[model samples]
Target: MRTILILSMLFCSIGPANAAKTKKPKSEEQKTLYAIGADIAEQIINQFLFEEKERPYVMKGFQDRLAEGKLDIEVKDYRGKIRQMIVDRQQALRNKFLDEATAREGAKRFPTGLIFTETLKGTGEKPTLKDKVRVHYHGTLTNGQVFDSSVARNAPAEFRVDGVIACWKQGIPLMAVGGKAELICPSGIAYGKAGRPGKIPPYATLVFQVELLAIIK
Candidate 1:
């Protein structure tokens, strides 16, 4: 559903380019439509973070569907495949990031693919799954775009050790109270295929900076 909506908006935005090649915009409505399309085009570019090499193929497909009323493949038959391609690409990116993160000095790669690197050592006690703890965390995607941050808000979050994602459940135990660590969670252990909608996409690898503030009694 989301993929369909994105493709629809992107293809609609191609109209302005076709119009530009033909003639100048003469009416207020045409000019407004052109501006709207330009904005949508910009949004799509930023959303995909598409590379220069991929732009031509994307524009060709859009032109074929919108301007030429033709398709090399049936849309209904290929939508699922297209979505899978996106998922696979995201997974590849995640794998690359995981490889680099695990190679970082002091990083520990667990069997579950969670990478933990302690930045600040703590002498205090560590919390178990049964314990509720207070902490501050900054969460981001592989691209370094922050999705959530208790640190930015200046408010610590409190929750049980096992109440969060699998990544945190495993990574937090490695930290003692007052410790800070970087947790790089592979998609399989962090939200997986069904990511937190609107804030995270499917197959996203999450990076987190976590500070264990206290273990609440």
Candidate 2:
């Protein structure tokens, strides 16, 4: 009789109240790790070098490499040497580009007196540290690669006149609104030892023709 009663109670309790499992679900760390590993593998290796079928094998190797917390390439290994070669080539190209750009700009400017136009005689307004002003400009490297131009981009650049690159801070405030000026910034004032990619080479001087469009404040 007691056993029958206990069985009845058990059946009654097995409704929604007891259908829920009581213990907290354990975190599936290893499963999550594998999924994360698979995602990273798809991004780095599969995107760059591998086919879809190559993922598992590549993932297996990557997991093993990561367990050691060291990339084989970074330990003075063969892979490291190959990476170094690529870097060396990039640096060499940068140097060659800079030399070519400087030579070309030197040939184009100063002698013809075409660069510095002395007609607009308005004095420059020195801006305070917090003042942002609008300016129109065209920028290029000595190699004649035009990088930035407010007019070409059809937008005006607003920046703190007292806190931008040395060339800008020094050159922009020397002209009044509606006045035009030219700046030939050396590599030191421009994108110096490590030049901006593609357009400007490393250690390259920059040339700019700027018009002070308006001062916002």
Per-candidate Cα lDDT values, in order, are 0.83, 0.58
Q: Which residue ranges in model 1 land beyond 4 Å of their true spot?
A: 1-54, 69-73
Task: List candidate 2 stretches off by more than 4 Å.
Answer: 1-119, 122-129
Candidate 2 lands at a TM-score of 0.45
Q: Which 10-residue window of candidate 1 scores lowest in summed lDDT? A: 7-16
Writing each residue's lDDT as its tens digit, candidate 1 over 21-63 gives 8566689988887676667666665445478999787766776
Clashing pairs in 2: 124-174
TM-score (C-alpha) between model 1 and the true structure: 0.78
lDDT of 2 by residue, 155-196 (tens): 988888877776676666556777776666666766777888
Estimate candidate 1's alpha-carbon lDDT, on a 0 to 1 scale.
0.83
